[model samples]
Target: MSADNRIIRVIKGRRPKVVVIGGGTGLPVIVKSLHEQNADVTAIVTVADDGGSSGIIRDYINVVPPGDIRNVLAALSDLPSLYLDIFQYRFNSKDAFFAGHAIGNLIIAALSEMKGGIFDAVQQLSQMLKVDGHVYPASNTPLTLNAEFTDGTTLSGEAEITGAGKHIQRVFVTESDLNAKEPPQAVNQVIDAIMNADVVVLGPGSLFTSILPNLMISNLGDAVKATKAEIIYIVNIMTQKGETEHFTDADHVRVLNRHLGEDFVDTVLVNIAPVPSDYLDHQKYDEYLVPVEHDYQGLRDLGCRVISADFLQLRNHGVFHDGDKVATEILNLAFQVGTMKKRRY
Candidate 1:
């Protein structure tokens, strides 16, 4: 059904529909928390990844990079810890052929080949994993991330763009081939989820590579702009190198607005908790530069109702958004929107 005619059936006392869009370590944390909270969650993950296990799998076989999807599945899966551990298990260096590949990636790759598409593969796997929520790849095919540096030089591939450590002007998605000028399109379900959702979320991931690439698709970007759903941006807790160094919370919102060609962000989640000097282990978390600065006035100028709190969690010396805290805030926003919608009737 077309978005215009599609019916959103809200059963009495049913969970609010929350669609989370992004890729990276943070995405799963928020999704898992939402699942536990009984929200009708849908995760739209990036397929532009070209690093580590995902990169290797995408290179060997023309399949969507499965690293982010694998993580998301594990997070929402209701399986036993031991079963998940086996799926997440990696091969030792002694196993040359399969070394460093996570078992889940292989399974996803195999399923992708069998199903003839990553989207279908993920759906089939979701059923077997007993996932509580839906997980959708932003694109059906592997996508290459292309970035333009502030100096006007352009680069292709997530690894190259990020490894260069240059200030990025913007990043967009394209077909995996470098020669392709057109971007791979997001599937209908992704658009439907965004339009039909009670609340739509973007990032706590890399602003350029992880979140923006998904929004770059023409149809997907258009749907996001047109969706009446309350769009919430979960800003990163820390600035990332080669992406948003020295960026404030407002800068993140500004970039998002610029990418989508308008200010669509209704709510902005900012972490006000301070990171102690030298708190992060640089060797372990090299990509993180510093805690993202707060610019309350700037966020206000963008017409976003800012929710600043101690959404910070420290684990293994790495700073992260407290999943439960963030999820609670998201649910509150969703409920508030729902309440307002009902009162307007």
Candidate 2:
């Protein structure tokens, strides 16, 4: 097809979508950038967190923790204004009922209760945020992540599993054998996004804990593989000490393949720049911020195209990506390069 014809085709009939699969703070970072870049982003967030606010919500109120979902919402909230600001606020009074609670989390939990389902709750909030894209819990049911340790002991929840300090032999959900009702909005939206998407991006976040948890759900792994969209795996800039201690770029992929299988990913976006060794002094081996000694060639040999760049965010008031810079790269990947996936062009 001619360039004009291709562009016309893309504009006329194309979805030019992006389906991001993961959870934790990083997924929203990707979502924020891509939403700005104008990819019809559909975030399939992991619902397996059994920690902190989310864990409390799940155990006490029998609802999915709104923390990560709230993060995704805030990230995609239309920039510089009321929606984002109101949702991102945390209560201050220690004696207050809302103390230590995020307004977003409260909103989502309330919506879930009124709407009578997690999916509807998210929809209600998304409409309010005017978020640039869609967000869904990977599963509708509040899920418990079950991890089997190398020592043959099984941890019952995500927080417990991660906190147990054991080498995870394999991780799976409690009702793995049960057929889950896919959050209708989530399942259909993700499938539809995939069929029309120009790119599907995964990770730069926690490996087993965050990313794979989503890929394991809603039959999402199968849907992703079935899509015609180019797939890109963005590698994390630093190693997460306890979860990814002494890991390299290749180790990340290795873990992905181990759970989801070897052919699960196509391309990996890696940071090629050298960080000052002084940065390493802060990255203790005790807390999951060890060095990410990347093996680019190994990933390439594994059939993943390693797209290199200076993909790091400088230190700031908050410890995360500079949104504008990351958004620039996201725009390039989605609109400029189309994709770096080897099979696409």
On a 0 to 100 scale, what is the lDDT of residue 234 in model 1? 94
* Over 4 Å off, model 1: 1-12, 177-182, 340-345
Q: Pick the candidate with the highest lDDT.
A: 1
Give TM per candidate: 0.93, 0.85
> Which 10 consecutive positions of candidate 1 have the poorest summed lDDT?
1-10
**Residue pairs of candidate 1 with colliding backbone atoms:** none
Residue 289, model 2, lDDT = 61
Model 2, span 250-320: residue lDDT tens: 87887777776646667787777666655444533334364478797888777887777777665631234
Cα displacement (Å) at residue 172, model 1 = 1.2
Off by over 4 Å in 2: 1-15, 175-186, 279-286, 317-345
lDDT of 1 by residue, 144-256 (tens): 88989889999999889989978888888788766766657889999999888888999789999899989998898988888878899999988898888999999999999
Clashes of each: 0, 4
